[model samples]
Target: MNLPATGRRVLVSGASRGLGRAVAQAFATNGDRVAVHYGSREDEARATLDSLAGTGHVLVGGDLSDAAGAASIAGRAADGLGGIDVLVNNAAVNLPHPLATTEYKQWAALWQQHVSVNLLATANLCHLAARRMIDAGTGGRIVNIGSRGAFRGEPDHPAYGATKAAVHALGQSLAVSLAPYGIGVASVAPGFFDTERVAHRLSGTEGEAIRAQSPFGRVASAEEIAAAVLWLASPSAEWASGAVLDLNGASHLRT
Candidate 1:
């Protein structure tokens, strides 16, 4: 697929580590200017910036739970990069909050946190980025990092699944609404990835069973997910807008 223009301004949320870090690196490697965003990991965010292949990358920090902060993040990234040409909503909270064992207060907190960060924040950024792209006539791209859990279900983390499902829906909606402006929006629903946060589980006793969930007998890699995001954001991927691509190694197929 053809890549975006050189120096294209891109913003990746939650880029302090793991999949987000990989996504930021992919854009930079493709010659795009990146904005690395983190929630509370300032040092890690700066490290991601330092690791980028090109210059002009910047770091943006904010709490997604605060609506204003989420908006501010998009605005700051746009200003830092001269204007945002792509948005990768990769930041999300996936806390395990099984209803069977969780107390009411904890369950409520989990729901609030997940929705605020995963769904609401993504929505806010989409709005901010789309508006700027429209006003500038740049016709940008927005790629959301959804999850297979949205379809297969997350029995232990209902909020995470629900928020991801909402993300797919939001992306589709934006794809239709923004098409007139040449903006393309899509989502990638990936299965468990071998990210640092999930490395322990992948090394535990249940690791084999988890790996066996996929026919390939392995979890997806962070770079694999980043590649999908990079392609979905490319100018050549305009025809793929409104798609919710499954990157689960056929582990969980949806009709």
Candidate 2:
């Protein structure tokens, strides 16, 4: 009922577009100071900044796939808003490589991008954020964006699926490890959305079918998923830590 996040600060990675943009807007609308981090597309990032409800917003740039880059980005976010009370790991890499015909070099390249951003970088940011929370003694929230690919598996998207599966484990582990320190970690894995990525991947009848097959008779809007992420980080969702909210709209149901 009381979803007020006044004075709270949040950091959302990959905020240039898609789910990240929506999540950033959700938090900002709820009175939270937001930091929108993006790897590229300065214009899109600027648009996100201008769209927020409040003024204590920041736009950070860095490639978080490496340890140094991750730390630097987290530092900038922290510095901008004084500190970060919530961290949403929504940045990801999705490159499909069929197992049979995929070159080893291709596989490794995809592996590097996926593991770095989806796993290592997220874990690194969590570590930094939790440390701040621990020192402040006020606790914190962390929401990791996961996918249904972990469950149903995406054809040719081995790297994507693997990283998403690992993301769940990482969130759960962080939840337990930081529970004593007053930090809550959760995963919100969604199925299909009308993101540009999704639209590009599916075409014509196939895309239409995928959208129609959902229990709701359509794919989710970015705002819908963003709302879920905000709840996970809100004070009301403290008890929901370490829980995975499967938001696929039952598209993967086995009949």
Candidate 3:
């Protein structure tokens, strides 16, 4: 199965802003049609759609925390893009839930939320899109946005860390399972990146420390991570399937 170099149908979840937006833009600029999925940011999603470099981009909105919603999201994206050649599972919930300071109720709820959005939704969409690809007889790619915290740990956001680890593992498993179908699967585990949601944390003392985490003395730009994601989804990256590429700038090395 030969994947097209451009003009592929791509679906990017949580594309209303930040990393999602960058990924969408990258694909769009590469001449692919994108289905930009958002949870509750229709206006921002439209902004993403409008900012695309080419035509055929569409907006898809649905709650990713619900199973039905995940199905709907995949269905709509497939319909909008005509078909899905690439699925980028980037939507996630990452609220802080330090075990010691958080109450049981809140901790449990956050864990559930993170699992639903970060892990389960991704699994569901992968199944949905992979089915479509198999039916169409078109090989595809799946690029999951994991996190460096999965390896280094997230003391303040245990659930986020745990779910991302699951995401990485899922991508590897699917990479093997889907290879027979000509579908490549991979993941990107990014460390600190500058985005609107975390802009505040990148300033003052906190910003200094965050930058210090990387030997480069700087956090990554969303575009840098997006570029890696774009490559992993490309036709040349099929051999990279089942690999979790680390983009941490030497912050935390895994030997």
Q: For this target, which candidate reaches the highest TM-score against the unseen true structure? A: 3
- Per-prediction TM-score to the true structure, in the order listed: 0.97, 0.94, 0.99
lDDT of each: 0.92, 0.88, 0.95
Per-residue lDDT over 1-255 for candidate 2, one digit per residue giving the tens place of the 0 to 100 score: 222366788999999998999999999988899999998777999998999997889999999988999899999999999988999999988877988989999888888888998888888988988898887788889999999988888788988988899999999988998888778899988988888767764688888788886878788899999999988998878799999888889887633
In model 2, where do residues sit more than 4 Å from their true spots? 1-4, 201-203, 253-255
Off by over 4 Å in 1: 1-4
- Count of clashes in candidate 2: 0
Q: What C-alpha lDDT does candidate 3 achieve relative to the native structure? A: 0.95
lDDT of 1 by residue, 1-255 (tens): 123566799999999999999999999999999999999999988889999997999999998778899888988999999998899999999899999999999999989999999999999999988899998886999999999999999999999999999999999999999998999999999998898898889876689889999999999999999999999998889999999999999999899
Error of 3 at 216 (Å): 0.6
Q: What is the lDDT of residue 73 in candidate 2?
A: 91
The regions of model 3 sitting more than 4 angstroms off are none
Candidate 2 residue-wise lDDT at 33: 93
> Each prediction's Cα RMSD?
1.7, 2.4, 0.6
Estimate the TM-score for candidate 3. 0.99
